[model samples]
Target: MRIIIERSNLLRSLGHIQRVVERRNTIPILSNVLLKTEEGAGLRLKATDLDLEITETAPAEIEMAGATTVPAHLLYDIVRKLPDGAEVKLGLNEGGTQMTVSAGRSNFRLQCLPEADFPDITTGTFSHSFTMKAQALARLVERTQFAISTEETRYYLNGIYFHALEVDGASRLRAVATDGHRLARAEADAPAGVEGMPGIIVPRKAVGELQKLLGEAGEDGDVAVELSDSKIRFTLGTVVMTSKLIDGTFPDYQRVIPQNNDKALTLDRSTFSAAVDRVSTISSERGRAVKLAISDSQLVLTVNSPESGTATEELAVGYDSDAIEIGFNAKYLLDITGQLSGEDTVFMLADPGSPTLIKDGGDEGTLYVLMPMRV
Candidate 1:
C-alpha cells in the first residue's frame, strides 16, 4: 500500500495500535501491525495478541490501495522520532517482502509480512450494548483497578467485576475488584439497555487499554460498549478494541463487606495519608504494616521494625466509639486512601480482627474494604 499521512496523525494512531503487539512473539505476524489503504476509507491499522485486538483508522492521502504488515514497534519508533508536522510517505516494495518509510530527509526500509497471515479475531453477535461518558468509565476503573489481584491461581479475581446492582434504593452500574486482603467498589448511574446485563469480568489488560483511550477522549466524549457471552468490544471514535472476557465466575464480594462496623473515625484525608506515609518510612520493607490506635477523638499511627526503627504520630479525628487498635499494610492503606477525592475520609470499624470499611464522606458511590494485618 502507498499513502501519505501527517506525522502527528500517524503517530497518534500508531501509539494506540502498537500497544496490542507483544514485545515477544511466538508467531511472526503477531508482532507486526496490519496496514491497509482503500480509495475513500483512508489508512487502517490493526494489532492483536490473540486475546485482545485493537483497530484504528487515520486520515491519509492515498496514492495506491494495498495491504501489508510490518514490525509495529519499529514503525512506531520511526514515526515518533520524525520531526513534528512532517508528512510521512509509505510504500510497499516491488518484491512485496519489504516496506519503505520516508519522512523529510530520513528513509528506512522494514521487512514486511503478508497481510493474509494475520489472524482474525471475529467479534460475534453482541447480546448487550450501552453507551457512557468516557470520564464516568474512567472513574470506575481508577477507583477499583488498583485492587485487582496479580495472582493467577484465582483467575476470577485478576480483573474487575462489572455488573448492575441496587445501591441506596437506586439501580446503578458497579465495578468491584479484590485480591482477598483488600477490595474496592465504585458505582455510576446505570445506562439504558444495561438493566439485565450479565456480570462480566473485564481482564486487567483490557481495563488498562480502555483507560488510555478514555483519557484521550476526555470526560465529555462518549464511548460505545458491546458485550457478548465471550467477548467485549469498546468503540472510541475511530478506534475499536475487542477483548476476550474471563470465563470464571467472580466471587460474591458483598459477603466480605462489614455491615455493622460500630466504631467510626472521621479525619482529614490529607492528614491521615501524610501520617501513614511518614510512619511507613521506618516500617519493614517486607510487611510494611502500620498500627492505628483509635480512642475518643484521638488517632495514633505507629510503625515498629526490628532493623529500621520505631516511628509514631498522632492526629485528632472525629471519633466517639470505644478504643480500638488495628494493624494494616501501609501500602494498602495508602492505595485505598489515594482514591478518595474528598477532604474528609470516614473509617468504619467493628474490631481489630474484622475488616474495616472506608469511604469518602462525600461520595457514597465509592467504598473500600481493607483486611487487618497482624502487627
Candidate 2:
C-alpha cells in the first residue's frame, strides 16, 4: 500500500497495534502488522497473536490502494525515532516483496509478508453488548488487576472475573481477581443491557490492553463492549480490540470474603501505607511478611527477619475491639492500600487467622480480602 501519514498519528496507531505482536513468533506473519490503504477509508492497521487482536485506523493521504504486512516493532521504532511532525510515506515496492518507509531525510526498507497470511480474530455474533464510561471501566481494571494470579497451574485464576450482581438492592457490574493470597473486588453501576450477563474471565493481557485504551480515551468517552461465549470485543474511538476469554470457570470468590468480620479499624490510608512500607524494609526478601498488632485505639507494625534487622512502628488508629495480632505479606497490604482513593482505610477483621476485609471508607463499591500470613 502507498500512503502518506502524519508522523505523530502513525506513531500512535503503531504503538497501539504493535503491543499484540509477540517478540518471538513461531509463525513469521505473527510478528508483522497488516497495513491496508483504501480510497476513502484511510488506513487500517492490524496486529494479532492468535488469541488477541487489535485493529486501528487513522486518516492518511492515499496515493495507491493496496495491502501488505511488515515487521511491527521495527516499523514502530522507525516511526518513533523519526522527526516529529514530519510526513511519512510508505509504499510497497514493485517486486511486492519489500516495503519502503520514507520520512524527511531518513529512509528504510523492511521485508514484507502477504497480508492474506494474517489471522482473523473477529467475533461472529455477540450475544450481549453494553456501553460504559471509559473512566469507570479503567477504575474497575486498576482496582482488581493486581490480584490476578501469575501461576500457570490454576489457569482459571489468571485473569479478572467480571459479572453483574446486586449490591444493596441495586444492580452493579463487579470485577474480582484473586491469587489465593489476596483478592480485590470493585463494582460500578450496571448499565442498561448488562442485566443477566454471564460472568466472563478476561485474560490478564486483554485487561491491560483495554486499560491502556480506556485511559487514552479519558473519562468523557464511552467504550462499547460486545461479548459472546468465547470472545469479547471492546471498541474505543477508531480502535477495536478482540480477545479470547479464558475457558475455565472462576472460583466462588464470595465464599472467601469474610461475612461477619465485625472488628473494624479505621486509619489514614497514606499513614498506614507508609508505616507498612517502613516496616517492610527490614522484612525478609522471600516472605516480605509484616506483623500487625492491633489493640484498643493503637496499632503497632513490626517486621522480624533473620538476615535483616527488625523494624517496629506505632500509629494511632480507631480500633476499639479486643487486641489481635495478624501477619500479612507487606507487599500485598501495600498493593491493596494503594488502590484506595480516599484518605481513610477501613479494615474489618474477624481474628488473626481469618481473611481480613479492607475498603476505602468513602467508597462502598471497592473492597479487598487479604489472607493472613504466618509470622
Q: Taking the tens digit of each residue's C-alpha lDDT, what string does model 1 give over 133-229?
A: 9899999999999999999999999899999977778889999999999999999998887878999999999899998999999868999999999
Q: List the residue pairs that clash in candidate 1.
A: none
Candidates in order have lDDT scores of: 0.93, 0.93
Q: Write the per-residue lDDT of candidate 2 for residues 268-331, one digit (tens) a residue.
A: 9999999999989887789799999999899999999898788999999999999999999999
Q: State in Å the error of residue 119, model 1.
A: 1.1
Clashing pairs in 2: none
- State each model's C-alpha RMSD to the native: 1.0, 1.0
* Candidate 2: Cα lDDT at 28: 97
Runs with alpha carbons beyond 4 Å of true place in candidate 1? none
Clashes of each: 0, 0
